[model samples]
Target: MSGTGTATGTPTGNESNLESAMQLMIQTFHKYSGNEGDKYTLSRGELKEMLTQELGNYLGNPQDKDAVDKVMGDLDANNDGEVDFTEFIILVGALTVACNDFFQEYHNDDKNDKKGK
Candidate 1:
């Protein structure tokens, strides 16, 4: 643990992997959040761009036509119509959990396949 940026929330380039990932998440959020009013949050267009660009692997090529709207609706917990940092974190956390579950299941399935063979 580099213990870097413990107070400032800025990455010191010497952080642990987990710390680096956290910084990346914050950086990614700010990147798109600045495109509209309330620089601390994501507008619908910014959210769409971020999803289409950053989450393409999981969200799909063009993604479901309704993915942006649906995701925005779900993530806007306060019904503010824009996703704030906390809401964004919730989305990321949920996706991470889902991905972890999926990979764990996949790994288990592969192990079972080898046993069957």
Candidate 2:
């Protein structure tokens, strides 16, 4: 709706659509870090390397090569390049619209529930 950042710090408009961003991040993370499947945990070096290689298209070419390096440095919670589950969840949650929309798309409510309507 409004292209404004909320008082609680929720970003609206284009910035709020985090699906692409999450997908990009996952793809990039998986690319450099060997996917451990259920056990997949990223190391700092693995995360940093993936960000440089995969996020280039989305994050843009840094004015200086180490620009992204600096960014990733800050985001890495354990000082490891890889973001742990909690950090990743928080980031995605901030970007997602709401829990209703999250489940709505998957449930396809429009096509079903016609037993009542």
- Which model scores highest in TM-score? 1
Candidate 2: where is the Cα deviation over 4 Å?
A: 1-28, 35-39, 62-65, 80-82, 88-117
Please provide, for model 2 over 1-117, each residue's C-alpha lDDT reduced to its tens digit, 9 standing for 90 to 100.
244354323344455455445445555445655754333555555544554565455445643447656655656667745666555555345435555585787578655776568
Clashing pairs in 2: 44-80, 44-81
- The whole-model C-alpha lDDT of candidate 1 against the native structure comes to 0.87
Per-prediction count of colliding residue pairs? 0, 2
Backbone steric clashes in candidate 2, count: 2
lDDT for model 2 comes to: 0.53
**lDDT of each prediction vs. the true structure?**
0.87, 0.53
Candidate 1: tens digits of C-alpha lDDT, residues 1-117: 355666535777778888888888988999999999999999989998899889888767525658888999999999998999999999899989999999999999999999999
lDDT of residue 90 for candidate 1: 93
TM-score between candidate 2 and the true structure: 0.36
Which stretches in model 1 have alpha-carbon errors above 4 Å?
A: 5-8, 61-65
